[model samples]
Target: MNYNKLVKQKRVIIERCFGQMKCRFHILQYVCRIKLENVPKIIIACIVLHNVAKSLGDPDFELVEQDPDEDEGNHENDELPLRQLGQQINKKKLEYYNK
Candidate 1:
């Protein structure tokens, strides 16, 4: 049934979209603490900004490439782990990455 191509077409593209979103706005990279009703508004705003940036040809703010073998859930996201947080940052950098 050509399942490999099917998976690539569906999952890969979707993940890439999400990865791009995270790389761009960064706020989507983690869980949100906002009210449920406000979540959609914030997402919509980010989408609009994303489209505008794409249209304007903004420089890509890349942090890392999407590794196919990378574990999406590798980090202990229920709480922040030490390494992913920049080693050189001060106490002022304690805010969430997506914040």
Candidate 2:
């Protein structure tokens, strides 16, 4: 048995399930807020609901393939300009020098 193939197969299945779950239930996208005792039940209920919705041909589960790395790309480029920061620092330096 090829380990890499097995891993890839499992990855596809798990990723698809997660994608569908998130697409259908926004609640699953974050941590649970339900009572501690009800957490298990709530999770099962959500999974059941997702499955039923899929079986009923719900279009909400339609997911696009997203590159997880794409989100982290160009994060530095998204940051605020350094010019304002430099100007502020220069003003502070001048104020200190004048003291």
| Per-candidate count of clashing residue pairs (backbone under 3 Å) | 0, 0
lDDT of 1 by residue, 1-99 (tens): 598989878997677766777788767888888888998898898878766555545444555759999878855664454443333233223332335
| lDDT (CA) per prediction | 0.66, 0.73
**Worst 10 contiguous positions by lDDT, candidate 2:** 53-62
Candidate 2, 41-98: lDDT as tens digits:
8779889877755554444565677887775556575346566655665665566558
**Residue 27 displacement in candidate 1 (angstroms):** 1.9
Which pairs in model 1 have colliding backbones?
Answer: none
Estimate the overall C-alpha local distance difference test score of candidate 2: 0.73
lDDT of residue 66 for candidate 2: 83
Highest-lDDT candidate: 2
Q: Per-residue lDDT for 25 in model 2? A: 80
